[model samples]
Target: MEEGAKHVVTGGGPQSGHCRSVSLICRPLGMKPHVVIEGVEKREDLGSMGNTLLYRMAGSKLYLAPQENYESFKRRVRKMKQYVSDTYGEKCYCIPVGGATGKAVFAFISLFDELLQQGLHDRFDDIVVTVATGGTSLGLAVANYLTGSKLGVHAVTIALRKEEIYENMDKLLKELGIDSVKSADILDIIEGYVGERYGTATEEVLSFVTEVSSSTGILLDPYYTGKGTMGMVGELVNNPSRFKGKRILFIHTGGIFGLFNGEMDRVINKEKAVTNDITPWLDENVSPVSIEQ
Candidate 1:
């Protein structure tokens, strides 16, 4: 964006992290953020919850539109941009759905550079990350190709098909003036983890997420990280030889807020025993401290 840009626009599903991030970033920069939500018809149904609540808290303007197609959504965003300019007399920068543009890929490239700086570039044999619009994984793949590292980038597809992600990667490659290399050659797209489509999770998967959070203290949302974890674990369980001696790093992108979006009730164990017993902690070596004022 230019120095004095007044408004920004982006589009995605209701719980899109990218849209929420844009709102957060824009607010701190004195720029107003506008989000064009997909498949939403009424404002009331959008509801103040999940990423939607975060967007509102950041003072983002919401525009609901139908998910007819990608091109149609783009057209609607263009119209929104025009409206912002005409109505407010200021330029509005529009971000594509998922921020899956060529420029956005560089953000992950920088992230990969940070990993190299932290001496983690060669510590892992495989990197597992969740993929929706594919920008993040493409950036990592570009970094891997540039650095000549041998680590594999496994992108678990939670929404789009493999071909769709590949297409997005190819477009990004063109933006970087690269040729003679195909996206599939550098990126591994993992599928079959999207249980009931995007933003939907089965009870088994949710239970797995609960178990993981309880054990590791890392909360994995059903939308992305949970599915990515399942895909990685499935690979290791089904084909142990592939990761027998290799160290795998699963990228835990933060989507914890989605867990509070009111779907966890289906996975809660109502019959599980709850206890507040502290007798086990009281031993002969244990003592309490006394303070005097």
Candidate 2:
């Protein structure tokens, strides 16, 4: 398995308090399992938790969590952090991009809680991280600040225009009661990988997607996975020193649905066309009887 890539295992059901459970077994080139997690799930219950409470606390905002369980948001974050640390290692951090799902926030807070439990309070030394343009980035920044960890979060983004991402991230941090949250330019880290449009597939990303599927039989969502994998690869290529000969983990926040619909249809159509073009000889082999007109 390559460094800074998500590896997922099949054959597991959803776990309580978690959206789903999948095993991540990471064994560096010549080393033992450097990182291993037994169960990881996206909390689907977040949507039904109610928006009224969220609106009351943070005002009627489209992105903030709903009012009902909005307060439990802190507890959820702690849970996620504990899950990662218990299964993986204390150094493990849940890296997720801010998107429509709103699960990353839960995951970030969970990590913070785990850190506190582990009593590793002053270990905030140049930890590498990744965030995207959305609530996930904001939540992560907030969690990092709460833990007082020095982070180098790569804000991976395709949607939310650059200026908008900056402003939104700032607003989110302030709202979450996190004052000092530093960030790095995601585009600068992934300049040529974004392709033509937001959520659109690029040649490099598609190739990487195909490679992962063929080699490891792991599927990646087109929009986020494709972009995120591209970002991770670019980071490894450019800043080899940060992770050279060291074990690094890339959090694979699930989003298989993003690969379906329009983009998947296009990919299917293209593949069918190629298959048809290559199998022209099969058409000649099948002889047909002539019918009288």
The TM-scores, one per candidate, come to 0.87, 0.47
Off by over 4 Å in 1: 240-245, 273-293
lDDT of each: 0.82, 0.42
Per-residue CA lDDT of model 1 for 1-293, tens digit only, reads 56467999998878888888999999778899999988889878888888889999998989998766655776788788889988899988877778888888899999988988977655778788999888899999889888885688888898888987898789889988888688998988888898877767888778878889777788998888888899889888886565424788888888887787777778673345121112343356866432220
* The 10-residue segment with the lowest total lDDT in model 2: 9-18
Residue 78 CA error for candidate 1 (Å)? 3.8
lDDT of 2 by residue, 89-179 (tens): 5433332222223444566667656755755334442223333345555555456555443443444564445565666555555555545
What is the TM-score (0 to 1) of candidate 1? 0.87
Regions of candidate 2 where Cα sits further than 4 Å from its true position: 1-107, 111-132, 181-191, 241-245, 262-293
The CA lDDT at 149 in model 2 is: 39
